[model samples]
Target: MTERATTSQPTPFATRQLHPAGSADVPWWRDAVIYQIYPRSWADADGDGIGDLPGITSRLEHLRDLGVDAVWLSPFYRSPQRDAGYDVSDHRDVDPLFGTLADADALIARAHELALRIIVDIVPNHSSSDHPWFQEALAAAPGSPERDRYMFRDGLGEDGSLPPTDWLANFGGGAWTRVTEPDGTPGQWYLHLFDPSQPDFNWDNSEVRADFETTLRFWLDRGVDGFRVDVAHGLVKDPTFPNFGKHPGGLMEVTHEAPYWDQDGVHEIYRSWRTLLDSYGVPERIMCAEAWVAPADRLARYVREDEYHQAFNFDFLETPWQAQPLRAVIERSLASNDSVGAPATWVLSNHDVLRHASRFGLPVGAPRPNGIGADDPQPDAELGLRRARAATTLMLALPGGAYVYQGEELGLPEHTSLPAEARQDPTFARTGGLELGRDGCRVPIPWTKGGASLGFNDTGAAWLPQPTSYADLAVDEQTGVEGSTLELYRALLTIRRERRLGLAALAEVEGLGDDVLGYLATGPDGRQTLVVANLSSTPIALPEGAQVLVASGELVDGQVPADTCVWAQVD
Candidate 1:
């Protein structure tokens, strides 16, 4: 394992003498600022129009300088490219489209050398339809061991033509797809909660469990610090094959009593994985769940002491931008995670969701569409960026680990006007364009202001076309520019690190007003930091004698402007 190092460079905020750190007492992830890199869009070194392992390695300095403690990489494993690499064809190999296994090793080594831990995505819930095991299952007879590895069952109708249950796929269409036997006769159907190209695994099968263990150790031995579990809540489904009753085109209406998601059996799998992680010894391996589970209490189960280390707080992400609703979700998230002795993880924008900047730009209570098209109503770009910065400031000041999506530091907004023909997400094809899908948010990151791909590759090639406006948001353009979103993030992260805000911190939610969200966080050293956001249309007064540390926007007359967030050191 690589040793951690302190940088000699000056921080944007006044650096403080923080309390001595204790690695054993508090794991690095507890208060970590982990950045998410959608590998396909991060950078393209070989210039094949797709981002790859070597490409990510070349850009490590960007993240290191951005003040992130670690990076959570999306999958680059061997795949058929169905569902954008979420469908794994070979769990142990890197896709040629990405790079060789050697490249992955080099990326991990280089990341560790920079004192940045690497957390890879582990999709245990399903494998690609083209996976070797799935191919074997296709040739095997019904009830065969190969078929037993997945959820294959007889259909409901007399002709065995209908799906076994009335479950709907999260992407679109029925959850089950009937397959033709090797003899050319229609056979049992297989269950897939997502796209049909991705088949769900039978977790009750010991072989499935054993294979995942091998996959985990493969990456662990390769020096990966941890994993971000995909579909973390949907692995173990009920054996009875119960119907969901209704078909929703989006995320399933899963509840604690739901047959598939958030099942009690899922915890058993996580507990076992936790044991495997512990077996790795010092500089502990961790797992973060991307589970979209229910109420705060239910979501907390995934992070119980013996289970996963962290679970994404989707409830917090789904909450509206209003002060009261945001505070309510924050309070519940903290209380629930605290119950399980785990730190709540906060996130604003990720690959799958609409970018928070654009989301906030919409009128309050407007529909949160998955994708934006040229004909769709446009978001107020200036308003969206302002609110996004403020929202991030508030998120970083809270008492836990925080996630920053790849281009979030640059205040990148979703490519709302992405043409339909340029979209590739399965949801778009499955829904026949009713839903624009996630392609808008997955555009390649712009590094330099001028190029065909805006400096994403030396050859100026990109898989997804970047917006013309990206020139203004390019990293080089904003790197040291005062009042730029990138600089503001640097300042906030610097303050957060110096104060050790994520470690041994206690937060007391202050009832400022219906339009203001305020909290006071006390670090272990007894230093108090007050975070306040004026989400209303009117400015709000800051606490008297509060030493301003960072503000998302300028303060007017000693008061925080509307749609602004401020972090101040208080007595």
Candidate 2:
């Protein structure tokens, strides 16, 4: 499509609905390496201080060279940017801040030329309140066809003055916002799950279902290999719209049962999407869920054979850096996905919460907090980097697909000390400084050693300021340094592919201390790779005669150092 080529053939394992490629008979995504690009912070091409499509195109080679198989780009669709680009106004057009539709075409072409797959972000859970449908809904009478496309109901109090339910906004307000009719009188309240600027779509509406299906085809025809479905689990809510007794919480830390997410109807929508993806005939498209639901088994439902291809493993990402919890999450994820014949996707830092580097450095077993302000206790940077590197090495050797967020390879931590006035995340503004927004991790990345924007922009202008400390961790500075974090990532990726570790079978090796994790990755060709991660402060003895292929840190007398991981060729 659009002259960008793709490979697709009927795989012998038809039950999998996956196409095989490369020298190995395995599906490309089974153990693929996917890089996530938070568009606004990645690079700025037009000098307006915002990263765009051309900026991302200019950096495609960096991904190719780093050995990643694909790029899962964050939403660059036309939007109000209220929740960044997640509040999409148009599914078919590109945001001017990111570039035009033509630029998107060129990006697909360039990525295909480099043999890299392209995955675009699709936000079906909600649309920008400014979207045509929502705008129409605002003008139409309550209970009309326009209003039916979304959830609109009468307020609970006298004369419909209050919100429809007791549900609280995930961002700290009423989840329902009342609309004003043309007559200047108060109208029915509408559902927003997120910010007031982003209205949740009623998935039960046939028009809504048809519109999303059309949106999928439009992108597939443009040659996108797949889509990263934003808030995938939140698409279909309970028909009754029952509110929990307490104020409704966020998708992240819902330790209790909730009706707002991971509903059964959501699976039917994906099944339809899957059928539509297969309609293309040959080149099969893939979809990954950003579903943060309860229970390992509930999350697995999103990736059944008839639904999406991959689901991000938030369980693993949210687990503490300690060994046992991490090991348990991994085991549970593998078992859950294996039951459905789908690959479990792994991710660490994204355009979301604090970067794992800083997160690991924090006190172990602490609650997952969002913002670490200037007044917050600073993280141990050295310890964080050590753990981050070791964790990356271990993740690369895992037997499934993995996602790498930008600037993470260079050991970039969250810009925790950003001033309040500089904050851009809606969560911060809506919560009145009580909750730290995602802006810290979304800060502009450093690309070069010297420049006002650290080579991210020619004008040294960025929408979000880059922390001065980023100058030392710039990509140009880390490009060739042997022990640099960038090199560690490149080497780990190179070794992973060369050894086919992604397609290998994993067997947990016991007898390691409670604080240490070890696993054996065995290839079908008889090649054995042992991966050991030392999460404790004490060093652990390494296997004798297992030649070290690569390591996160230096070993002392055949002992794996604390917070270090090693990939060894077993004897």
Candidate 3:
């Protein structure tokens, strides 16, 4: 993809008008550090070997003490669990696996009491194949309104033999799936960008749009602070259903001209949602787009003034562990988001990819496979943890918001040796085990050191088995341990909030080599904090007279060690 030409003149930080901490005038999402909770793997309150809302409610104190401003929960809606709740059968109610609607209500109320905001995931690009609407579409005739709500079209060849287009599914194989008619005849094909169990919605249909609005209101009335819109960029597709000539990667990759993603029509949908959110008025409900678009400028469109309030910086997440590329992504991200008057959201890892800790431990240019197996070359645990801490320290020092995926604070590594039969991700099945899929990263996290399932559930069972190494990294093991990863995270977060770093504006530091990343974050009060990351093989001297605040690793005679990051106060 081509990079957008950036103007040399930087916008004045003062003109950005970032809201002060605790100010009710602006929305809380801006500059907030949000934590992502993969609910099904977070905790199990009912002893059913799966996490539920009550389990999440019991864990709120952990997040509150961790210093995050908000928590973004992945989908726990009524679903068939075909794509881990992404295939939603009912948007209005919680699935029994995750507790009842009353459980959801109590969770929201409890979070509010702790001064924590809640942002639920909303999968609007598609619905579960078993949804009532999709069921109706299946039962209805080809030309019926029920079928119009989804992307249903006649097949290409005679007797409906071929799919209409060659667009590939994000998971694998063809994106189109043929159906059997009520009369037992071969029928038209339906589009599903991911799994066959998920049918893509026809966003052009008025009924679909109206229905999503009602779902939005239903949650807003239930006291949710906002939503994290999944597949935000893929909602509105090119009407022609043009073929994507070459499949780039297994994941939905960065393609500037892909007909199915980053369509301009998506802005209109988000703009409407923005209006709905603003209408609430009191706590300022907001939406963050989980768009994987590219070129920085195009990605910024999702967060334009009248559109989404924030968008994930996947470009940053994918950047290799090199200072030069990391700085480039940071600068471009800040520039693009600044152009649109939005804060750049930084994230290292999530439920989808290999954990950053493991990724950083691999060779500098090694590929980041979705899953790691016993046969795969393992990551260097010591090296990975060191770099992970440094990367997070550098990320937290940057301007704007940040996101921490579940178990990241404990420095959890991916469960590389999960048996094949235990894998549940659709990608693994679709790819015929060639790709191990994301199940490795989504394993249940450890809460206590000794348990049958690492304290994930009361029954000593877990939906996904935990790695034995997790016992050492459990919350109970690291809670009050000095120099532990968990304590390091707490300290970093405390410093980040006290310094108001998230509300500051950053400027690149001159004279830093290609092996080092150096920037100064200047707060509204003119207090400057210097953040420097040494990705080089050797030690780097700290700037003269900079008061050291925190370092990812111990300083070696007043110098930042290799694979280390330091945050300091400077005049």
Model 1, range 195-300, lDDT digits (tens) per residue? 9999999999999999999999999999999999998988989888788865533342255666788888999999999999999988989999998887889999
When summed lDDT is taken over every stretch of 10 residues in candidate 1, the lowest stretch is 1-10
lDDT of 3: 0.87
Residue-level lDDT tens digits of model 3 in 174-290: 899999999999999999989999999999999999999999999999999999999888888888878885553433445557778888898899989999999999778989899
List the global CA lDDT of all models: 0.87, 0.85, 0.87
Error of 2 at 49 (Å): 0.4
Extract clashing residue pairs from model 1: none
User: Quick one: ranking by lDDT, best first?
Assistant: 3, 1, 2
Cα error, residue 549 of model 3, in Å, equals 0.9
For each candidate, C-alpha RMSD in Å?
5.7, 6.6, 4.0
For residues 447-493, what per-residue lDDT tens digits would candidate 2 score against the true structure?
A: 89888899998998999888888999999999989999999999999
TM-score of 3: 0.95
- Stretches of model 1 off by over 4 angstroms after superposition: 1-25, 248-254, 509-511
Candidate 3, residue 320: the lDDT equals: 88
| Poorly placed runs, candidate 2 (over 4 Å) | 1-23, 245-256
lDDT of candidate 1 at residue 129, scale 0 to 100: 98
